[model samples]
Target: MRRDDRENWRRVSRRRFIRLTGATLSLAPFIPLHASAAAKARIGVLKFGTVSWELDTITHHGFDRENGVELDITYFAGEDATNVAMLAGDLDIIVTDWLWVSRQRAAGEDITLIPYSSAVGAIMVKEASPIRAVTDLTGRKIGVAGGPIDKSWLLLQAFCQRDHGIDLAAQNDIVFGAPPLISEKAMQGELDAVLNFWHFCARLEARGFRRLIGTNDAAMALGAKGPVSALGYVFHEDWARANPQAIEGFARASAQAKKLLATSDAEWLRLAPIVKAEGTELEKLRDRYREGIPTRPVAEEEADAAKLYLVLAQVGGQRLVGQSPEMAPGTFWEGMPK
Candidate 1:
């Protein structure tokens, strides 16, 4: 058989194996002792990185069980693919960066933000590098994993333009490549800086990279209050509309999970390994988990994330609010289910 055919067969076989043996996959340990059995709910999780904590909890903790749903998950590369899958109906829901939704809305794509997570991605530089601060980023090359239209890249650019008067679009050398390659290049001194989320940045810092700036720092610098800063969840509008009960069940589970995470730091820490199983060290995992996990259902953070996208839309020559001030502001996270 051809290579593509072989790969396709492998995928089919793998999924079939899961479907056949998933019942025996042993949910005994993951599910809470008190969880009640429920119906099945298949959800797609785009494997962006370490943000699987919420999903892990949903699947493992019997949240789905209690709510009459069995969570079936599909993981993908990043927000782009996840959003595409959502649009194509291959995925019913997706957890991705809020900016993806904003861009989708700007393009008239039918997606909705279900809930907001917290901010975490930050800029990393070698500790010995002469660039000590964000202001020093002038005239230096910066690497972002996602390309130009990425929300983080745009936000970083806005920060530079608004604060230092340096238009990154015009002056800075911003490169897009795989995070591993970027991290390796940054380590070899081939690049002055690289942008990374907490997981990778922690590894960089452990290897002696200094944090030049982050969304949190920029938020403080900009005096942002109730502004959205980073990642969140999205789902197909039609799917959400049609499967209101399923959606409500998922949301209810999420609220419970968020509540548990907020009140119990110890429990949250114990659950970190599930999210960080892809080789993140304990300390780094703890740090990344703590950065935003505790802030689930934080209204101010969600609002800030929506506004961040609106601002990016403005910068990209798109009006998020449709040129009506009252209509625009409310359009963002306006009809979101509480």
Candidate 2:
């Protein structure tokens, strides 16, 4: 042991410590900046193929964390399961329609909704089929999503009754089934026409099927015309009130993501795998996204809702429309962050 040896050892130790500190500092920037500051929001998503791709956009592009929302996303089989989760307090937010929230509020649930999606479903007939107009559907074999209580089905009936002097539920031999199969059956010529969710309908249309009527068109035929985003992001009122900033953050992030998707084909192509979409289905999906994604929340009363009550009352009856001539105040929360 010598003094010089001890000095050399001290220098080595100091050099090792400095290198270790530098390495740690290099990794520090990777930590999510808003992980601590952002509020956590547990969101339920219904996996409707590419119909909910905007949600995928938010996640794929890191919009959630960027906008200060710590997202806890859970996917359900469909809207019904998501609704159950929302009612059971298992979720903070869900992708749903305003009608569901309004119905729950009518039944004394403390539920409210914000705009999320709109103009995303349609009725389709084979491209070569003879069904050219609403009047042409009589005596045809048709397929529909949901059932007699299905909103799209009921909307068709109401629209026909009001404008065409007919009832779709009665004029056609309507078979109720799942959405995916409806498209398949139509492609196979098993049905004359099908009322389906937007993405599937668009896919079919892209493959040479024709839309006899889109959901927005159905709304219009019922005298409720405009680009009303019927679908919404729903939350229990108390959860929304307690986490206003988080809610606003999430809303803004969603808006940013939606705009990104609508404007940038490259973004859509990048995120197409989220829905397992490829090839023509992928392009069709992009078209559907372009058709449905609203540039802004339909905030104007006329365009935002467009005699929305008639659609609700016709589809869901008293159980959904309730006694209110219009949506109860606060039922439709336009509380997005400015």
Q: What is the Å distance of residue 186 in model 2 from its true position?
A: 0.9
State model 2's lDDT. 0.76
What does candidate 2's lDDT look like per residue over 126-148, in tens digits? 78888899898889998987666
Error of 2 at 210 (Å): 1.0
RMSD of each: 13.4, 5.1
What candidate 1 gets wrong by more than 4 Å, as runs, is 1-40, 106-110, 219-223, 226-229, 258-280, 294-303, 318-338
For model 1, residues 39-145, the per-residue Cα lDDT tens digits are: 34456675656546667766667786676556678877666677677777777777766555655665566666655455466889887888887778777888887
In Å, residue 173's CA in model 2 sits off its true spot by 0.8
Q: Give all TM-scores, in the order shown.
A: 0.72, 0.84
